[model samples]
Target: MRLLRVELSRFFSRRAVAMLLLAAALLTALVAGTTIWGTRPVDAAEQARAEARVQAITSSPEYKRDLANCQESPEDLFGPGADAADCRRLLAPSTADVVGRVPLALADEVDDSGIAVIVIVTVLMIVAGTTFAGADWASGSMSNQMLFEPRRQRVWWAKAGAALVGTGVAAAVLIAAFWVALYLVADARGIGTGAAVQTDIRWMVARGVSLAALAGFGGYALTMLLRHTVGTLAVLFVYAAGGEALISLLPVERSGQYSPAENVFAWIRDGGRVFDSSIDCPVSSAGCDQTFQLTLLHGGAYLAVLVLLVTVVSAVLFQRRDIP
Candidate 1:
């Protein structure tokens, strides 16, 4: 308990971690602010402009020609069973379409700005974790710390715990703040988020926080193994870029299912679909689609396995290897 407390205090006291957390907060605020500003209720002037644009588009010769053709051959444009009524409904221009702006929607932001904020925080936390561990090695303080504690395993786990707890708490606070800001903005604008959407947002925030914590743990482990911040980052960069490209090149079924990025997104989004264009389709087979569903369970398992492997290897090496 004493060691863990010490490590936690050290983790939070690091300047690098402090700066990264501040950056994450600022970035989250920026994203939330942008979403609110961009999605603000369309003013009277904008509404009038949109209405004028819609009127102009509806009265245009090109639009008239397209509408005429659609009504005459609705099935051709809209597939079988599509009638002239469908053409009329689809061809009509609306002020909403012309304005191309929507009021703040919590549900939509969950998939958009929400995901972006999570990714940003996750990346920064990874760096924070790496920096925290790498600093010990870089400053040759690991040797001194070990001289005091002597039990390498305890030290290892203490640092890992500190990284995980610190990163997770930071992520949760920032993500919750982001959501609160958006929600308040929406409420002030008379927009209501559905109960279902609120539930989804909560689940998303939980998953995002967990993902970030794990990522930070992984970064710390990798840095411990490599004993250099840049080395760990370089390795991650190569794997992220090269690994996906290599997976795409492999002639395997549902190649995209193995992509780390795809799985990460799947985990973040609960579940996601991946389209593998590399899948060879038989010419004789019609409507051959190459989309595959990646469940959250699959993504969660893959990430868990990967981080476990790295953490284990790193701990084992740190225990056995000689500290310079």
Candidate 2:
């Protein structure tokens, strides 16, 4: 209990930690505000003005001729018999197609807000976990901690457990707070309420918290093994930014199975856009179409393997190494 309280006090005393929490809150508000305002439905007057402008273009004689010519050869961009003037005909908005394409949820708004929250929460958790563990070793605090505890493995587990629980609680609170703010903003903007929308919001919050926990654990493990803040941060930054970007550039087919990035990206689904996948295929590939159902299973398995390997290796290293 004494050790736990001491750790908690030290964690909260850091200015950087406080700043990160504040930043997450501010970012959540900003993203939610933008999403709600930007995607609000146009008023009838605004729609009418747009319609008038479209009518002016489509009612022209050139537009009529163009429509007639297009009817004869719909796919051809230009040909010997093509009427150049008619080719510029303004298209009438097809109600059928518009209605058919209407998404079940407001994707732009949800994604804009949801993705920002996820990223901020995840990054903060990772940074906190890494620095908390690594700082002890870097500053020679671990020697004292271990000396006090005597049981090296217990000391290690205590730190890891505290980090996991603390970060997880912080993530949950932030995510829930963000979700409530978003819902209120969305309601104010008169976005239609539905069970589906509520479900999506819940799912987003849940996933954000889960991902944050995963990132925190992963960072903690890395810090334990590396025993240096600089090294841990370097490796994490490389994996999170450079590694993912490089993997994205590879041929779609080759990347799906081999890229670690793909393994982590399979949990987000806002409306029709699926954010995360467990399948080992490029997101844009035909393979995704065929293997969509298998994504969650594959992704879970992969993440489990990675977490197990990293945790075991880090534990072994920490147990064997002398504190500097």
Best by lDDT: 1
Separately for all candidates shown, the number of backbone clashes (residues 3 or more apart, or on different chains) is 0, 10
Candidate 1 pairs with clashing backbones: none
| Candidate 2 stretches greater than 4 Å from native | 43-52, 59-65, 71-90, 93-112, 240-255, 269-294
Report the backbone clash tally of model 2. 10
Candidate 1 per-residue C-alpha lDDT over 198-311 given as tens digits, one digit per residue, 9 for 90 to 100: 999999999999999999999999999999999999999999999999999988889898899999999999998889988789999999988889999999999999999999
Worst 10 residues of 2 by lDDT: 95-104
TM-score (all chains, Cα) for each model: 0.94, 0.74
User: What is the clash tally of candidate 1?
Assistant: 0
Q: Per-residue lDDT for 209-301 in model 2, tens only?
A: 877877777788888998877798898778768877776576564355444555555554322323333336666666454332326456556
Please report how far candidate 1 places residue 262 from its true position, in Å: 1.3
Model 2, residue 263: what's the lDDT? Answer: 58
Give lDDT: candidate 1, residue 265: 96
Alpha-carbon runs more than 4 Å astray in model 1: 81-88, 278-280
